[model samples]
Target chain A: MPRSVRVRLFATARLAVGRAVLPWPVPEHGLRARELVAALEQAYPRLAPTLRGSRFLRNDRYLRDLDETLRPGDEFAVHPPYGGG
Target chain B: MAVRLTRRPLTLAEAERRLRARPGGAVVVFAGRVRRDRRRGSSVVALEYEVDRVPALARLRALERAARRRFGASELVLWHRLGRVRVGEVAVVVGATCPHRVEAFDAARYLIDELKTTVPIWKEERGRPVRRPPRRRARPGVRSAGSGRAP
Candidate 1:
């Protein structure tokens, strides 16, 4: 069974993804950062296009690559470029 | 002293009174209001501003630190509105108090300026006159017009 993780969305991310929080089922080995992105893209079709070239943050730190394993209880957020001045 | 984020309209008197109670010699405040125009060339019948509280609060806290360090203010209060805001509604208010006028004024200005570029917010124009996002190549850099959502 895949580890279940909580995905939290905020601001533009919430608007695009259409929810404030989501439960993600990851593989037993755990989902890597990149794999999470692909899963998110699959889950939210409307957000998939926007996710292209967007950035990801695990907790507060920015994730540059997907090799990091997803931890249970971990909160992930997808951040679009901040457009505010 | 207090950093507040709400969708309801802000009260200038409340902000001023709170700052004055802190024994500061000077208090400076900046309020951003919704206007009649939007980036997409929309007539801006109305606006809805949206904010993600988790990251938004984090960013605000960082700004408070920066304001205190750069302007030497005694206290700072930053309040922002998130949700649909009608035209002419108050969207944000940042108040800074200090022992001198210089620190008060500088801190207030710096806080607003930095927030415009740093915060993660979104704005959606509604009703009429749809406006398009500005071309990235446009000169004179446009500030991100925040979402119309109110808290």
Candidate 2:
């Protein structure tokens, strides 16, 4: 079976993609976070601008490095600048 | 219990009560309310707040620990309201209790600032559409220049 990752979008990212969640395909060995983001940008060109300003999360944890590998069935989230108080 | 992301209303009284649980010489509480701001000729009626629950809670907990370690906070309250919050409603309540007034104030400030910049929460304003003035109709027998009526 083909490996996949769950791409979660929040706030502006969700608005740009018009959905809260997306299933993104990946290789069995998974791909680097940078490559996954690039694939997402290619798939949703409108989301490129939002992606540039967003922070990434891997399975509910903030990712400080984009080089981190994302394995199959992992949940990756795109969070725009926070506006909470 | 100190860190919360609720969907219900947040009250200053509740936050104060929570902070009072710990005996401290100084307790500071800050409440953030949704304002009816004007935007593009429209008025903001409410703010819709959304969050990625698991991560938001995790970050809040981390912030709580940091506040305690850095500010010597004996007690802390970092409650934030989710969903649609109307104008003038309390959107968030942050409080800190410390042995001294300075630490309490600083801790409270830090809590709110960090929450805004670090938490995984977002708010979108919902505004009322701008109302335009009704156009005046040319009265009968009133000769308007643009109506092609000779003056």
Query: Which candidate gets the maximum TM-score versus the true structure?
Result: 2
lDDT of 1: 0.75
Off by over 4 Å in 1: A10-21, A41-49, A52-55, A60-66, A83-85, B38-41, B129-151
Regions more than 4 Å wrong, model 2: B134-151
Cα-based lDDT at residue A74, candidate 2: 90
Report the C-alpha displacement of residue B1, candidate 2, in angstroms. 1.5
* Best model per DockQ: 2
Give the alpha-carbon lDDT of every model.
Answer: 0.75, 0.92
Instruction: Give lDDT tens digits, candidate 2, residues B1-151.
Output: 8999998898888888889999899999999999988768888999999999999998999999999999999999999999999999999999999999999999999999999999999999999888989878888989656767557
Model 2 agreement with the true structure over A1-85: per-residue lDDT tens digits: 4388899999999999999999888876778999989988999999999999999999988898999999888999999999996
**Interface RMSD (Å), each candidate?**
2.7, 0.6
Q: What is the TM-score of chain B alone in each candidate?
A: 0.77, 0.87
